[model samples]
Target: MWEVFLYINPLCSFCLKVEQSIIDFTRKNNIDTQYHFVTTSNMETINDYMILKGMKPCDLEGRIGVTQDVYDASLLYKAAACQGNKKARNLLMNLQQEVNTNQRPYNDETIKLAVEKSGLDYKAIMTEKSGDAVKEAVKKDQELACKMHVEKAPTVIVFDDEDPTKPGVMINQFGSETSEEIINENLIAMLEKTMPHQISEPKSKYYTNDSIINIERYRR
Candidate 1:
């Protein structure tokens, strides 16, 4: 099994695509994996998102709640995560697609639509969105990013759960066609190297001169 921490901006198009690819790859392979979708609260990351969208900081002045949208989305994501990781991920993906693909604003309407589409309890999320616990969760995510020295969004940290002594592998290269392939290869290699091997004694039909013994090895 692997523990993956993916730090991303909920509104970043590139981050959305990369997240989808990673999820598809893991599900396709039926890998035992845990994903932590950490929405970044850094200004640099927000600037990068704006740059990717071909917008300057000045443009945000006219769009109300634009700057605060990032933090708001982060809170919403954390609230959604209280229900389930999948729901939280779906909410982010929906928000990204609306903002990036549909060219929609991250306002109340967009957030509501995304939450509805993500199958979240709107009442529950709203009740918990600004709660102390959710705020603490978001703060913890920020602390984790600082501890890991993550200064940008769309960063992935892969930890080999079987071997905790080893450091987590950091992946920050993305937004290229080859990024998916690169991540896929790295994940496969890590699984091969770190996944535990099992050996069991097999029932033998024939006995040897000394004993009936057969050893079977399986890699998972």
Candidate 2:
């Protein structure tokens, strides 16, 4: 009954490893989990975050270099999310896998393969060029990420159904750690500690109202 949201960017080596770690942890522990993939470019998001945190834009790496192709791919990911959950997760993860694993830029063939594996028509998703849809999806996703206060890639927030109000803890760069076993153990502990009670179940009588983490408190 607990929910865990994994904010990830597939292109990062660390993120890819974290994804694998989560998968292994879930499989081994028999946990039901949900992954919310953040398709935004980390550098751009970080720049915005720094500014929001009252940091100066002068410190940002705008002129340092960012390819438009990556931005385009981000939009594509948002578009996928809009269609459905299954399609979105599959395509988003697969595309990220392809992009991260590849040494070259985004290729039609690679993207197509990712789409097909996701049970989608690669050509149709590619051909649909509705500006508003892509724009709105990307905007909503960015807004959500900002609301989540995510500062980096592959950051995970674990929630316990029993305590629903308090999210247990979070982890950054779960994958590619020196010890994968340790990482899994830590995640399992967090998962066990954070899961919230389901709506079908009784609410906690001990909730003092002081320890609850109100999701609405998050500022955009």
Candidate 3:
């Protein structure tokens, strides 16, 4: 019963792991949540933004080198998002893994391979590169990142916008939970407090520092 603004990239294994965990948690617990993934048609620009953020401009394998023009890659991500399909998420996730794990000198074929493995309509995703829908969606995402202060990948927030008296927001701090269990533990309690639902609540002693969220390389 909370609106979770999960800012994540598909390529990040950490992101993938966290996402999978969250999905599992929701299904097992029957929690109502929403995901806001920023990938697909905005690939190139986000990468550029990452480079601008100082990620070495190359994958761990050094396979894909950076280009002066990042338009195509940026469009790849944003355009995929516009399609509003799970395939787009798959494409971005596999693409991220490809760049992160592959060897150096990544080229068109490797990218194509990542796309194929993701089970997306490669032709459709490619065609979307030139379409206005993807371009506009990418812009919107960028603007959103700016407005929402998401400067890092995998930015997660647990929020409820129903309170009317104070009706503000409670931000979550990352790295607060001592362990994975603690993370889920605290999340359940917080969710109940915000939505008052029947769920397995975590121990609240975890809030010693009174922080439930963390901002990683994310700046406003």
Query: Which candidate comes out best when scored by lDDT?
Result: 1
Task: Judging by TM-score against the true structure, name the best candidate.
Answer: 1
Q: What digit string (tens of lDDT, one per residue) describes model 3 on residues 70-162?
A: 345557766665556466666666666676556423456766887778665667777888888777766776776665555555555554534
Q: Write the per-residue lDDT of candidate 2 for residues 1-220, one digit (tens) a residue.
A: 4455667553444555666787777777677765556655556544543443355657535323332445666766766665676687778778767765664446777777787888876656765535677777666766766766666655666655555566446565333334665556556545544543311223222111112265544322
Regarding TM-score, does 1 or 2 come out ahead?
Answer: 1
| lDDT tens digits by residue: candidate 1, 79-121 | 9988998888899899999988899977888888999999998
What TM-score, computed on C-alpha atoms, does each candidate reach? 0.77, 0.69, 0.61
lDDT of 3: 0.53
Residue 39 CA error for candidate 2 (Å)? 2.4
The predicted structure with the larger TM-score, 2 or 3, is 2
lDDT of model number 1 = 0.71
Count backbone clashes in candidate 2.
9
Deviating ranges (above 4 Å) for candidate 3: 39-74, 101-106, 159-173, 176-186, 189-193, 199-220
lDDT of 2: 0.58
Q: Which stretches of candidate 2 lie over 4 Å from their true place?
A: 44-67, 102-104, 127-130, 173-179, 195-212, 216-220
lDDT of 3 at 170: 31
Instruction: Quote model 2's TM-score.
Output: 0.69
